[model samples]
Target: MKTALCIGGTRFVGRHTVEELLAHDYDVTTFTRGIHDDPFADRAGVSHIPGDRTDRDALESAAAEVAPSVVIDFCAYHPREVKTATEVFVDARYVYVSSGSAYARPDVPMRENGTPIHDCTPEQATDDSAESYGPRKAEGDRAVAVAAVEGVEAMAVRPMLVYGPHDYTERFAYWVGRVAEYDRVLVPGDGGSLLHRSYVEDVARALRIVAEEGEPGEAYNVADRNAFSLSESLELVADALDTEVDVVGASERELAAVGLEPADFPLYTPRPMLVSTEKLASLGWESTPKADAVAATATAHVENGRDGAENGPARKDEEKVLEAMEETSA
Candidate 1:
């Protein structure tokens, strides 16, 4: 059996990637920091190696012990981080989980191009500023390309707006909670904004596909096939929950009064975001239906009890927005 090593495999997308790898009958070994509990480690074909990835000796020791055939890195954020992982897995096929925000003008369905370089530097990439996330990711992506280990090469998987079970961001769950708890939901502007998102399952499936069959040294954008508008996708969620929500298009001013910003609302892109998956598809990549994915996400959110301050605006805050709208209409 082929052994696969996943760094940071106990959390959201990382956890799902491990699940995908295990489902494929690969002997899966997860490397983590021992900060959380993982139910997967209890399974028949899974193992856990807990330690700080920043610790080079520990990382090298574990790599030698596992001797993995494939390594999927889910936690490296900059070139320094990438260098550390690549040094350890120089002989194995690699998958570096990169971000779509690495593009400067990710306002569109970005293809694998270099125009978005908005000036990439080692300094900008190494910093931890909110502004540095994308640039830092770009630097990391570059590192993966240059570090191309001998024999089997690495494939960079860039995913956009990942959401599903174990989503600590609570972006998608916020909408799921709104549909479940409130009849009148407040949305940004007209809520016709379009954006791209990669479901956790979809991303995991693509990662496995690339690991097994993808071309080396090639970067692929792993995103959903369709560009969905906020209102349109929410309708699918509403249908899933058997609930009708009177969607209100609140101006930014109204949201600001309620302490909400444009970014605070999930899926708040002003334009269409249609990321190209042609490269990934050429390697046999497929996706779950967008409608089905959205419905399943809503169901998972409600069942997982993700409704709280962590998800997004609290119910009380939403209720206050409703009150304001009601007062305006009255």
Candidate 2:
């Protein structure tokens, strides 16, 4: 059986990637800090190596032990981390998880080759602020290129906002919960805001495919085959919940009346953010249908009792905005 080593596979995408590898008949071993619960602790074909990825000695030890044919890295946030992993796993096919944020500009359909990557300053590379996230990911992509040039089979997979089961981010769950509990939902902007997102399983599969079939030194974008508007997404959640909801579109002034900005809402962007998935699709990959993905997410949200209260404006604040709108309409 093909041996695969996953760096950081105990949570979120990492968790799903391990399952994907197992489904494909690979002997999987995950390397993590052991802080989070291990979902694969008793799985038949899965194992774990407790270590800090930032420590080169720990990574080297894992590399020496597994000698993995493929290494999917989910925890490499900085460029330095990518550089070290590429050097240590130089012989294996290494796939680095990058982000759509790495693209400098918000193009309508951010193509892998057409878009310019965000430049990382020396300060940005070391900083851990939210503002520096994209630049840091971009620099990590560059590091992969450097390794590929040295004959390392290194590639990058840039996934846009990922949502699905086991999503700790809970950004999407906020909408799922609102749709489930409320009769009317408050949507920011004109409700046509487009934010491309990928299903977690699709992203996990992309990591495996890119590691196995992608061209060295190239970056591939992964997102839902179809991008949805904010209003449409809420509608999808409602459909998944088997109910109907009044999606109330809120203007900037209306939201500000309740002391909330459009930015305050999770997944609300003034400009449309999209990425082209043709590059990844060309490798014989396909994305889950948006409806099916949403259904799965909604089901998981209910099962986990994730209200996503911290992800967006509180329900009480939303009610204030709704009351103001009602008075204006009346």
Candidate 3:
């Protein structure tokens, strides 16, 4: 059986990737700092190596132990980390998880080669703030390219706004929670906001496919085939919950009247964020159906008791905004 090593497999996409690898009949080993619980501690054909990824020696030790055929990296935030990992796993197939944020332009459909990559300054590469995240990821993609030039089997997969079960980011869960708990859900900007999303399972599958069949030095974008508007997404959640909700759309003026901005709402993008998955589709990748994916996510959200209270404005704040909108309409 082929052996696969994951750099950050204890949570979110990493966790799903491990399960995906196992389903494909690969022996999986996850290298994490051992702070979080390991869901695969007892799973068959899986192992764990506890160490900090930033530590070169730790990574080298794991490399020597597993000799993985493919290495999927999920936690390399800094460009230097990606550079170091490419060197350490020089002999293995390396796939770095990049983000759509790496695209410098706000093109309607960001293409892998068509869009310019955000340039990363030395300062930005090391900075951990949200502002620098795209630059750092763009630089990491450059690192993968460099490794490929040196004959390493390195590739990058860029996913946009991944959501599903065990999503620690809780961005999508915030919406799911609102649909599940409230009768009148507040949606920003006429509820026509579009933010492309990739289901966690599909992303995990993309990682494996890119490692096995993708060309070195190329980056592939991963997202659901059909992008959903913010209002449609809420409707999907409501369907998943076997209930109905009145999706209340609040205009920018309405939101501002309550001392709120559209940005305050989670996943509220003033401009539509989209990326083309055609390249990945060329490699034989297919996304999960939107309705089915939302169902699974809703089920998991309830099971995990993830209210997503921290992701967006509090319920009281939302109520205030809703009340203000009602008064103006009256």
Candidate 4:
């Protein structure tokens, strides 16, 4: 069995990717801070190593001990983080999780070869400050791209807005939940703005594929054909819930006036965030349709009450921190 090391495998896309890898029968080892609880804790074929990736000695020790064939780094945000990981896992293949924000002001249909938002060079370390999420990740991408040792290669996987079960952010869930309640939905920019909607599970699967089959030194955009308007997404949610909903057109500034930013902008914003998945598609990957994916998400939302809609805290990170604290105490 092939051995794979996963960082940040206890939540979100990382968690899903771990499950998918296990389903494919790969021997998996996960590294985390022992923060979150995983349902797979009792699974027969899995192993978890508790440590902080930011701690160079701890992470390096884990890497030297595990020596996995592939290291799927889902948690790294800074270029220094990548450097720390690479120093410890020099012999393994690397697959870094990046964001589509790395694209430099992308055109409507963003391609992998699109204008880069930042130069991909190791000399330029990514700034990990919260505001520079995109640029930092891009720098990490470059760091990994240039630092791989002989017989070891690295690839980067960038994904856009990901929505699905257990999504604590509730960004997508907020829109879906509002529509389900039969409320007047706000549509940003006449619902003509297009953004790539990727189901989290599909995005997870794409990450696994890129780790296993993607070309080294290249970045792959893991998005589906479901480029949609904010209006279309809301309609899908309403249809799934069999609810009558109203959508109001609002500009970015208008949404901002209501305490909503483009980041918080609901399903109908018209800014195009298209990405060409030809690179990933060439690897024979398939994704669920947008409507079906959202329907599934709606079902999960109702069942699990993820996001603040269910009366949880506003930010997913807050909930995660609480969960982590609980785990630490336990």
What tens-digit string does per-residue lDDT give for candidate 1 at 1-330? 999999888889988988899888899998889888886867888899988887888789888989998999888876688877887888788888988877777545578854363456767867878788888777777777777644447778889888777887888887888778877777788888877889899999988998888777667788778767788777878999998987878888887887987677767876676688888888888888988888888888888888534646666776777788889899
lDDT of 4 at 151: 40
Candidate 4, residues 1-330, lDDT tens digits: the string is 888899888888887888888988888889998778876698877798988888988877777778788899988988888766766777777888888878877677778776666654443354445557777887877766776533447888888878788777777777766676535655545666677878888888888888788887788888776576677777888887778777655555554443554554443333577888877888988889878887888878867765345432233433343344346569
Which one wins on TM-score? Answer: 2
Q: Where does candidate 2 stray beyond 4 Å?
A: none
Instruction: Supply the global lDDT for candidate 2.
Output: 0.94
Q: Which has the better TM-score: candidate 2, or candidate 3? A: 2
lDDT of 2 by residue, 1-330 (tens): 999999999899999999999999999999999999999999999989999999999999999999999999999999999999999999899999999999999888899999999999999999999999999999999999999999999999999999999999899999999999999999898889888999999999999999899999999999999888989988988898899999999999998887999998888888989999999999999999989999999989988998787999999999999998889889
- Give the true-structure RMSD of model 2: 0.8
Q: Give all candidates' CA lDDT scores.
A: 0.81, 0.94, 0.94, 0.74
Better of 3 and 4 by lDDT: 3
Which ranges of candidate 3 are over 4 A from the true structure?
none
| Reference-based lDDT, residue 216, model 1 | 72
User: Model 3: what TM-score?
Assistant: 0.98
The 10-residue segment with the lowest total lDDT in model 4: 310-319
Error of 4 at 185 (Å): 2.0
**TM-score for each predicted model, relative to the true structure:** 0.92, 0.99, 0.98, 0.85
Error of 2 at 304 (Å): 0.5
Q: Which digits, one per residue and each the tens of the lDDT, describe model 3 over residues 76-131?
A: 99999999999999989999999999999989899999999999999998898999
